[model samples]
Target: MKRALITGVTGQDGSYLAEHLLRCGYEVWGLLRGQPSPHRSRISRIADDLKFVEGDLLDQSSLVAAVDRAQPDEVYNLAAISYVPMSWQQADLTGEVTGLGVLRMLEAIRMVSGIGRSGTTSMAGQIRFYQASSSEMFGKVREVPQNEDTALHPRSPYGVAKTYGHFITRNYRESFGLFAVSGILFNHESPRRGREFVTRKISRAAARISKGLQSELRLGNLDAVRDWGFAGDYVKAMHLMLQQGNPGDYVVGTGRTHSVRDAVRIAFETVGLDWSRHVVCDSRLVRPAEVDLLCADPKRARAQLGWEPTVDFDELVRMMVEADLERAEREQRDVARAPTEPEGDW
Candidate 1:
């Protein structure tokens, strides 16, 4: 069977992508820093079928060893400290994990059995790579709908680091003739989304308030706009990028932008609530630097990959809200049956 490796396999996108690859009949392997992490209720199920490998992206030895063991035909580099606000607090560690980490993996492949001389690409069977590029890189909003050729002016350290990962993938493809591609993915969401991300945070909060589990949801910057899609749909775009005759970059998104307020309204409407009473905005919760608006221009991906988003915003919101309700019900039932548990960080 064809084999593929994914970093950040415990994350929302990673879980969805692993399911996609498994359905396609590939043996899927995931890169995790330590032991399998405790899953968020919405994502706990995907944890069962996946195979986890112990490795660290920041450590060259671990990367080389993991890659050598997996010998994957395709490697999806989805691992990064992705949240923009978190980047402000963890800038130094973010620089190490989000920026330099890509180079470490590339170097590890080049030196499969030996040490890599600086500035070199990999040897044969080094594995075709797909970097998880983001629309956040177009930080200043040069154009209404961003495409591959758009000039990037990343405002946050997270965007800047992802830009490095994007260009380095392209550089290796041009310089060493490696099969490396970058997919500039826009905001994709699912029920598995962390509570910190606005979409899930809104959905989870709505589910709670609707069920009388929580009174309010605290958020920041409702005016901020994002182009969001279903995570399952976006994962298909990643697989399509590698299946092309030769590796090429593509922009994958729903090509629609909605404000954080609009998202709140949708989630509230789904759960039947007045958003004003429930959503309490705190100035402290906002990001240090925010990308005001992002909408994808998918003309190239449409013509080339024959891809278009299957889920629209309303459907996406409803689905996420429903998932949140189901999870809350499950948690309530579990808690009632078992003893009270201590709070834990996800």
Candidate 2:
């Protein structure tokens, strides 16, 4: 059976990708940074099927050890300081984990694959690599519906780091003949999304507000537009990229744009609530350098990998809202079952 190692295996995309790989009959192993949490409930479902290794992106030796232990034929580098706003506050940390981390992974692959030897006969040449590049790399887009050919003008440190990772993946493919490819993914969300992310925050708020547990939802730049797709659908494209005979970058998205306001409206509407009444625009939530719009031209991914988004914009919003609502209901039930303190009992 083919073996695959995934960094950031606890994340939303990582969980879905792990499940996908397992279903396809691959022996999947994941790199965990620390002790596992219940929050990784998505991957925890398939815990029996997954092999875990403790590692960190900041430590190159740990990554090399992970690559050695997993002995994977494919490595998916998804671990990074992914939060955009967090990147602003922790620019140096972002540069270390997101930017320098790619180089470390590539080096780890090289070490494990036995680089410096020539020809396809080498094991390193045989192992494939996939880097998760974000469409945020196209921040301050020169044009609408960015394709692979678009010049990267990243606005935030996070985007800048992803851009660096993208180029390095390409460099490894060209210079070392490693089967390394970068998937320039647009905004993709799912129920498993972290509450810190805007999409999930909105969905969670909508669910809670509908249940009368929340009074308001605060956000920034309601006009900032992004091309969103389903996380489940996008992970397929990542797998497809590695299956290809050639190693090349591809942009993946639904080729459509929607604003934060649009997302809020749909999310609230899904729960039968009016977003305008409950939503507030907080300037404090705005970014230092915002990426106003990011729409994708996913023709290359479609034509090359035979991949297209299965979930549309409306469907994605509804799915998140529904999932959050169910979660809220479960939590509420748990709270009701808990025994309360006997009226001021010492």
Candidate 3:
């Protein structure tokens, strides 16, 4: 079986990609910095199936060791300081992990693949690399429905870091002739999405309010637009990138834009609630630098990779809301079953 090592395997995209690789008969190994906890519910279902390699993006030696241990035919660098607001607070950390870390991974791959001083490979050109580039790179877009050729004008520290990563990936591909590709992915979400993300937060709040568990949902930038797709569908495109005869950057997205208000409205409507009743606009939550709009032009991905998104916007929202609703119901049931403290215990 082919061996694949995926960084950030516990994340939504990584979890879906792991499942995809497993089904394709690949021996999947995950690079993790710490002990695997059940709390990583995204990958909990397949945790036992994954081999773990201890490593950190911030540590080049650890990454080299991980590459040596896994001996993967392909390496997916998905681990990064992904959150935008957090990137602002920890700019230096994001720079180390999200930006410079790509260089370390490329170097590790070079050493492992036996690429010589001339930067040419001999082991049948093995050890392909896929860097998870983000649509956030198109912060202040120069054109509508951004393609691979659009100029990057990143606004946030996270986007700037990703832009660096993207350039380096392309640089290595050109200079070293490494089989490296970067997928400029748009905003993709799923039920496994962390609650810190706006989509998940909205879905969770909608589910909670439907069951009378939450009073209100505070949000910022309801007018901000994003091109969203299903995480599962996007992972297929990642896999397809490696299967190609040549390496090139591709934009992966739904080719449509939807506002945060649209997501919140659809989420609430799914659960038979009016969003205006519960949503509170909090200016404090707004980003210091916001990308007003981001939509993708995935013509290349479609024409070249033979890939297309299977889930639509309404369906995606419905799926997230339903999953959150199920979780809330389970939590409510657990609370009901727990033994109560004595009335005078306090």
Candidate 4:
């Protein structure tokens, strides 16, 4: 079986990608910064199926060690300080892990493969690399729908860092003859999405309010729009990028845009709750520099990769809301089952 190494294996995309690769008969190795037990929840179903390699993006030596140990046929670097708002709060950390981290991985691969050396042949046995670039790179978009050729004008520190990672991935491909490709993926969500993200936040809150567990949902600009796709579908594009004859950047998205308000409405409706009753606009939740709109021109991904999103916006929202509702119900059941203190003081 082919061996593959995945960084950020605990994240939504990483978990989906790991499951995908495993189903394809690839022996997957996940890069873990610390103890594996703490991060097992995301990939618990496939945790035992994966080999964990201890490493961190902040440290080059650890990455080199990971590469040496895994000796993977393909490497997917998905680890990043992915939250856009958090990027502002921890700009330096984001730069270190998200920006410079790509460089370290590339260098590690170069050292391990030795493909770019004077006597070494470039095509022999080199690990293919995929950097998870973001649509946020098109902060102040120059066009209606962005594609691979779109110019990057990153606004947040996260987007700026992702831009650096994107360029450096291409640079290594050209300068060092590495098989490196960057996928400029648009906003993709799943039931596993963290609550910090708007889509998940809306879904979880809708579920909680429906269950009488939460009182209100505070959100930022409800008009901000994004091109969203299912995480499972996008991860397929990542694998497809590596299987191609040539290495190049590709934009992966659903080609459909939805606003934050649209997501809220769909999610609340899924839970049989009126969103307006519980949803409240909080100015403090707004970004320091907001990206009003982001939609993808995914013609390249469709025509080239033979890929299309199976889940639409409505389906995606309902999926998440239903998942959260199930969780809330489970929690309620557990609370009811727990033992209570005796009526009399003990």
Candidate 5:
């Protein structure tokens, strides 16, 4: 079995990608910073099959050891400090993790060529690299339906860091003749989305409120738009990129956009509630630098990978809300015997 390594196994996309690669008959290994959380629910169906190894993106020594130990045929660099507003508070750390982290991984790969590291098993030419670039890189939206060729004007520190990761992937491919590809994925969500994000926060809170478990849901910038797609479908595009005869960057997303208000409406609509009554827009919740619009031009992915978003916006929202409701209802029903824990902290 070809070994596949993912850097962010705990994340939504990484979890889905692990499942996809495992189903494709690859032995999956994950690079994790620490041990698994006992309270956290895993989205990856093949969690038992995935081998997790401790590694840190900021540490070159750890990455080198991880690469050597995993000896992966393909490496997916999906780990990043991705939340935009949080990036403002942790700007420098975001740069270190999201931008320079890619550099550190690439350096580890290059060093495996027997250039710098002693007694390192070399497979630099054989390992394929996949970088999880984002549509956030096109922050402020110079042009609608942002494509691979679109000029980037990133508005947030998160976006700026992703842009660096994107170009660095290109640098590795061109300079080292390695099989490296960048997927400029737009906003893709699923049930596993971190509640810190607006969509999941909306759906989870709305579900709780419908169950009489919460008071109200707060949000900001309901007018900001995003081209959201299914995380499952986008993860397929990442795998497709590795299967291609030649490596190239591809834009992976649904070719449409929806306002944040639209998401709130759909999410609450799923719970059979009027969102206008419960959604309190707090001015403080707004990002200091907002990415006003994002729409994806996914023609290249369609043509190259024969890919299109399988789930539309309405269905996507429904799936998320339904999952939230299931989770909340189960929690309430089991409360008599179940051990109580604090709310999900990050």
Candidate 6:
């Protein structure tokens, strides 16, 4: 079986990618920063199936150690300070982990694999690398639907960091002749998406409101548009990029756009509620420098990877809402099962 190492194995994309690789008969190793217990919930079904090694993006030595131990044929560097809002709050940390982190990983691979000055590796063999580049890199987009050729004008610290990662992956590929490819993925979401994201927030709130567990949903930038796809579908494109004859960048997206308002409406509709009744636009929730629109031109991914999104916007929204509804119902059941506290029992 092929051996593969994945960073950020607890994240939504990482969890889905791990499952995909496992199904394809790959022995997956996860590079984790600390104890695995806290992250087990994300990959509970396949936790035992994966090998975990402690590593931190901020620490190069740990990364080198993890890479040496895993000795993977392919490494997916998915670990990053991914939240955009958090990136602003912790810009320095984001730059360290997300921007410089890619460089550290590339260096580790170069050293461990014994890559020489002439772009050749020793007996250890060449390791294929995939850097998770974001659509946010194309902030203040120059084109209507961004493709591989579009110029990057990153707005947030996260976007700037991702841009650095993207270029560094290509730099390693050119300088050391490493099989490195960057997937410029658009905004993909799943039931596993964190609540901090707008889509998941909408889905969770819609479900809770339907269950009478929540009354209001605060949001910002209802006009902001993004090309969203299913995380499972996008991960397939990531894997397919490595299987290709040539290493190159590709934009992976649904090639369709949706607004925050549209997402709210669809999510609420899925849960049998009207979004306007609950959703309140909060100015404080808005980004310091907002990216108004982002849409992908994924023709290359379709032709090269033979990939297209299976889940549409409606289906994705419904799926997340339904999942949240089930969770809410379970919570209600657990609360009901709890014994009542006796008054003045002390």
TM-score of each: 0.91, 0.96, 0.97, 0.96, 0.92, 0.97
Among residues 3 or more apart in sequence or in different chains, the pairs in candidate 1 whose N, CA or C atoms overlap within 3 Å are 110-122
List where candidate 1 sits over 4 angstroms from the true fold.
40-49, 113-126, 334-346
lDDT of 6 by residue, 252-287 (tens): 998899999999999988877778889899999899
CA-lDDT, candidates in order: 0.86, 0.91, 0.93, 0.92, 0.88, 0.92
lDDT tens digits by residue: candidate 5, 1-346: 8998898877899889988998899999989887565313564466778897889998999999998888888999999999889899999999999999999988777666444333223334467889999999998777887899999989889999999999999987777666789999999999989989989998899899998889899898999999998899999999999988888999998888899999999988888899989989899988887888898899999999998789999999999999999989987788767777879979
**lDDT of model 3 at position 294:** 97
Candidate 5, residue 316: Cα displacement in angstroms equals 0.5
Q: For residues 71-125, write the lDDT of model 3, one tens digit per residue.
A: 9989999988899999999999999999999989998888877776577643264
| Candidate 3 C-alpha error for residue 248, in Å | 0.7
CA error at residue 227 for candidate 3, angstroms: 0.3
Local error of candidate 5 at residue 93 (angstroms): 0.8
Q: Give the distance in Å from residue 50's predicted Cα in candidate 3 to where it truly belongs.
A: 1.6
Task: Summarize candidate 2's per-residue lDDT along 1-346 as a digit string, tens digits.
Answer: 9999999889999999999999999999989988756567878789899999978889999989989899998999998889899999999999999999999999898888877645243333377999999999999999887999999999999999999999988888777788999999999999999999999999999999988788999999999999999999999999999898778999999999999999999999999988999999999999988899899999999998999889999999999999999998987898889999788856
Per-residue alpha-carbon lDDT of model 4 for 1-346, expressed as tens digits?
8999999999999999999999999999999999644546989999899998999898999999999999999999999999999999999999999999999999898888865554234645779999999999999999979999988899999999999999999988887778899999999999999889999999999998998888999999999999998999999999999998888899999888999999999999888778999999999999998898899999998998898989999999999999999999998898889999889966
TM-score of 5: 0.92
Q: Residue 55 deviation, candidate 5, in Å?
A: 0.8
Looking at candidate 4, the ten consecutive residues that score lowest on lDDT are: 115-124
The residue pairs that clash in candidate 4, if any, are none
